[model samples]
Target chain A: MATATKMRFGIVIFPGSNCETDTWHALNDQMGAPVDYIWHGETDLSGYDCVILPGGFSYGDYLRTGAVARFSPVMGAVMEFADKGGLVLGICNGFQIMLEAGMLPGAMMRNVCQTLVCKYVHLRVETTDGPYTRAMSKGQVLRIPIAHGEGNYYADEAALADLKRNDQIVFRFSTAEGEITPEANPNGSLENIAGICNRERNVLGLMPHPERCSDPILGSADGRLVWESLLQAV
Target chain B: MAKARVTITLKKTIMDAQGQTVEKALHNLGYEGVGNLRIGKYIEMELNGAPATELPAQVDEMCRRLLANPIIEDFHVEIEE
Candidate 1:
């Protein structure tokens, strides 16, 4: 831990945010630190080092995941917070909302398989260098769980080229057939993109649930590095 | 009143996982005769452009600012008399 006083971290809890507690536990208890739970309606975001958009259907997945929730009062604060170069992490539905909110680029469409996916997925971290990835090395694969129906990411060629040129491509799906093509793209993400970081390199969003992987008792402990990164960043 | 039809879709290079899944669902439901199920959104709007002169730029700005993300989503607009 970075021995910083007042290590404030807030996780946005929306109406259907089912992973808030798990995220809270992973950050505060499992990781030996504490965080605050902020409602989606709260407008003030003062004195916080990290902010998280936890997983779950915000507004029951209406108007696309995170689309409606993005208009919430707190999101304005989030946008401001992100604009100032603070660390923000979005997972699963959080990731969906991040896309819809235009906090980052690309929108998540429905999954290619058309069914709700719920299982562990292999995510190859691409030289992780953000606040949430400080503890992990680049090209390391982490087995994390993913559960969502609209996890496919799409964008224009120019935008994708920007993501590539900027090295903003964070996580990708390793093809089952020993290739890493978009065809190997699980959930139909273009260019096999799984995770991404914003322009300032402060905001991070990933489809996999690192909070769920913090403890080995649940299934795997591959998520510990993500939490550890936060601890190390401060 | 002059109107326009707007179609929004993911770029060709970007994969449409949802459409593919729907296609698979159709096949699983015994509707196997279909192919290439690409999905996009259609929007209809009324415009105030006079003489049909500035309609193109106006609609383009509308889609560019709010309707589409320049990064991944593309849109087509058609003017209707």
Candidate 2:
């Protein structure tokens, strides 16, 4: 097994982002991966092997979720880091920021029910080739929680096809039995996509809170596979 | 100074769940002749200086870059005379 100390994680903190501490603790304490809180105003991320944009109502989700926070100074550094092939993970609101930053293709729209959904959902790992899913076998289902109002992932047909062709689709909402169904999809995301990665496979954006489930006490430590995968890959 | 009014709406193919919900509410309230209610954003901004001369293109840029997300929404800009 790869030692957790091998990977250094930086979780960005934007005003109105309430999940930074959770992410920090998950990485630093629970997973034992060296982690630090990188403020949104910071312009440097050279010290980290991976950058995480943790879930939260960044910039109060003003204008649009992540629309404002994408301009944060740290994002410039984060983008540079991603362009240079460093790993980047965006969870929930962080995923929104990634979409707004154009680091990932597509955008998230209001949930079909037009209400905030926060609960444990089953996600089937769609691809294991990416750094984030290396620990999980294909078709493996993990229990993770998604909390957000805007998680309806959408893209043009061309973009969607491209994502599929490149095997960039990382995970899909699924039933506990690993069956993908509309009833299992908490959000009306296109094709029930819960997560995806860039063509380079370095940047991943998903609408689930993996950090919340990294601890066994949380009732499900399935998310640990992702964190462990990060350490193993780096 | 010149002002630009921007109207942004989801693309035709995209599902507008909020608008659908609002439409259902209107139907329950017995509003007549409500057809295809699609909720959108209306923004008004003021501009000054040389930028005002290039208002249309500038507003287009704004819509493309920030005011609207081209993936799911389309934006129309109207400059005040």
Task: List DockQ for all candidates.
Answer: 0.42, 0.85
Count of clashing residue pairs in every prediction: 6, 0
Alpha carbon lDDT at B69, candidate 2: 86
* DockQ (model 2, Cα): 0.85
lDDT of 1 by residue, A127-211 (tens): 5667777788877777888888888887767888888888888888774333467655667777778899986788888888989
Model 2 residue A199 CA deviation in Å: 1.0
Error of 1 at A229 (Å): 1.1
* Per-prediction TM-score to the true structure, in the order listed: 0.79, 0.97
> Which candidate number has the best TM-score?
2
Model 2 in CAPRI terms: which quality? high
Residue A212 accuracy (lDDT) in model 1 = 92
- Best DockQ among the predictions, by candidate number: 2
